[model samples]
Target: MAVRHLGEFVVIVCLTLVTSGSSYAEQLPNVVFILADDYGFNDVGYHGRLHGSAILTPNLDRLAGEGVKLENYYVQPICSPTRSQLMSGRYQIHTGLQHGVIRPPQPNCLPLDEVTLPQKLKENGYATNMVGKWHIGFYLDACLPTERGFDSYFGYLIGAEDYYTHMRSYNVGSKTLSGYDLHANKTTVYQYKGQYSTHLFTNKTIDVIERHDKTKPLFIYLAYQAVHFPLEVPDSYMDPYMNITDKNRRTYAGMVSCMDEGVGNVTRALKEAGLYDNTIIIFSTDNGGPIQSGANNWPLRGSKGSLWEGGIHGVGFVHSPLLPTSVKGTVNHELIHVSDWLPTIVAGIAGGALNGTKPLDGYNVWSSISGTASSPRKEILHNIDSLYIAPEILPSYFDGEDFLWRFLARVLEDKFDTSIRAALRVGDWKIKTGPDASASDVWQPPAESGLHTIYPIEKPNQKVWLFNITADPLERTDLSGKYPDVVDEFLQRLEEYYKGSVPVRYPDPDLEADPALHGGSWGPWE
Candidate 1:
């Protein structure tokens, strides 16, 4: 490992760390966890995969320059599941969310029995704060952030909302304007209506940091609603992208740029408050960008909803002065999962292991990030979901006697069946099995200059495909036929892993009380 000196600070961009022998004092380091919703792989400058992206994310690039880029970080395919795993350090199947997200007004949430990150951190004398996008579940007050573990909560309750009005939309043309989404500590604050949500969330985060008591360590979870759907941005942001003729793509770029600026403001606030050096900053995306939302996860396979590489693999980095100066501006190719953050953060502050609790599917990966040790995470069960045919079992999937029966069977039986969609990554090999494995969400480049291509649906395949992901990150060739023994061993392992999983927890839709909110269409309740 080569090292250089920048002023009195040693700089090392790509090397292992030699510990500085820093000791834990009375003032533990502050944590600022920044999560981007549906951010793309190629959208940032550091990835070096997207040849010429219109997006300019200077703040994110700066973060990469200041810290270690996690080259092999993995996350769940969608918002709620990823957030669930992140919060509890467990799989979504164990936590009551398996296939999709938690729709509003449904009596569902992160299971009360499970321990959350904030809960554990609060026990360790940290001020827990959350700003923006808490999509886990909020039907009941107990399910909300304030009731969970966050000392303070400021953000929208449901999924994607109108960037300006903050109203939850049911379809492209219909939105419940009266249904208030924005809130500050469980109370709706509509006065900030018409304000750009991305800016408002950033302002709230900074305010928290400014007013935070310095006596104890702080935990700030800033989840940005940027570059998602319902695209809207200030003219100043979009003006620079006028050369890009694709209007949706142009708006998307502006949104990303606005987010980048917000990140700059956040780090700036930390410096202004003299808390920059004592902070551990984490920047990562919730899931892959959706093509319909004009996101470009190029050179990877799938989109936000599928189990392919694009949907699960995401951007991540950790910046902190606590790490040895020798690790600055480096890249860590260690495998990390969303579930690892809680234990990792806890261990970093509490100075001990979280033993005597339920065994977690995640491991503390701080050593992996600091380059002190190789990643302990050797394999990950990406996901296992069956065809969720809502039409056939609408109310039963959520409520009613049928739901009770299904729920009981799920928890009581060894329900791992052949009819399931799943993916597993162990060592250098990745194996995916399902009816939808071959379905590609990749958007092709346009033949005409300056125009963005439309989203195309790839034909599905029923057979499995195996690849040595380390060698073939693009998954260009299937090695299953040539390596039959390897494929068989992986299949057996996947099956055993599946049988050990808990049943999927379905929230009650309660149709009689509230109708199912359909996307891309709107109608009155039945």
Candidate 2:
């Protein structure tokens, strides 16, 4: 084994640590997850996204104040991957889904067999309710929320929707305002008439909480479709920001504020129902925002679909009344990834939640929150898209494959620079490996030159190399040639990490296909 790989193993080992059945702290706590669409890192009051802006997110601000605020957090580069990671506790590729924010008649959705977080929680006696967007994938109806484990489901299977109309269009035959219906026990019993996406979803969640059997706790995965594209502010929120200068951004801010209010409503409902203290509400975005969604991500470059920090890095947290003082208001600096949600939540609920799967990828931050331990990921891989050399359940299999292909073709024309495009930041050192020269300009490796080398560390002077990320967060300078030994080690780790991905099976097919009935979709980003 190479010394660099050895160093990487050491880093991962320190992360593994030792654990047993339960830590006593892993008690039964109700779970509520609010996933914002196209949300930026600094958008909320806690993160200063709305600090000097006209946007007012008082609800989220209050939530952060009452609970803990997480700074060092991450999701996939786009919506699909994040939902994939959120549900299966595995990497996007492993889950068998590709494409972020799929169009209606969306193809190649999440595969069946992946054990969802709700299913795991259900095993330990938690009623699961999923309301709002279910954008994991929708080639078929099986991908819906209820099929995956939600006892009750209400929301569009696609990514985003027209708030007022409860209907929108992606194409001629593929347009339908009414989203699919998902149910666990009785189909008609769970049937509902969808309203303005946000309000309707929130009302359903409140109803679920209000009517849930308090005996067995509950897990509500509230995936909000707010603040995404096809931007529209409900009449209520639009009145305030409607008067702003930038029409798009004004409505965008209004959408964000309305979403924040929705979150507040849910939290208020929890408190009103007396479930607030016992519940652990996790807040995060499915992915970053796009150009049309509003430029909330300033300091960070890129947005939504791009693989930059602004695209993959979004705000997130696990708010529980039981959070230890050490972890509260503290930004966990350890390395973390998307797949950890399953085990992390399990770790919180302990015996009350699940016992089927071992620690997959994500670490339970609770112990670290208690100041008893820290996470292992220091230098993390924040790839937004699937790194699959090939894809399973490819688009060719779907009847709508041709349509999706055309969409992809149109999107590729204005594609971002892949060559010299993507970058990586390991502590202070940053290495940028853009879209392959061959990928865009057909620059062949070896035929020209493509050797793995490190940056900022010099041993054998190499010209095109890496740099110190801390001193130059923008990664303006290339010091790979300046430092050979250090560069070589870091380069090796990147190689192995890219080459290594333990694939997990897709979730149950019925669950995956349940939400896509009647060819429903969430516009461009859905």
TM-scores, all models, native as reference: 0.84, 0.73
Sliding window of 10 residues with minimal summed lDDT for model 1 = 1-10
**lDDT (tens digit, per residue) of candidate 2 on 1-526:** 1101112233222223311122312335678888898876556666543333456689888767766565556677778778877887766544545333444544546667677888888887778888777777655446666677878876666655566655544442433334433322223222343356677778888998898777776788888878777787666786776546667767777788888888889989988987776677888877666644553554454466655456666777666665655555656544445666676665444333334543344555455444455554455555423332112223333457486775576356433212223345566565544432121111111100122212222223122347674565333456766886766666555555444544433332222222334254231222
Candidate 1 structure quality by residue, lDDT tens digits, 7-27: 111112111122123322445
Off by over 4 Å in 1: 1-25, 48-50, 171-178, 388-418, 437-439, 443-460, 511-526
Clash count (model 1, backbone only): 2
Top model number, TM-score: 1
Shift in Å, residue 427, candidate 2: 4.6
- How many pairs of residues collide in each model? 2, 45
Q: How displaced is residue 326 in candidate 1, in Å?
A: 1.7
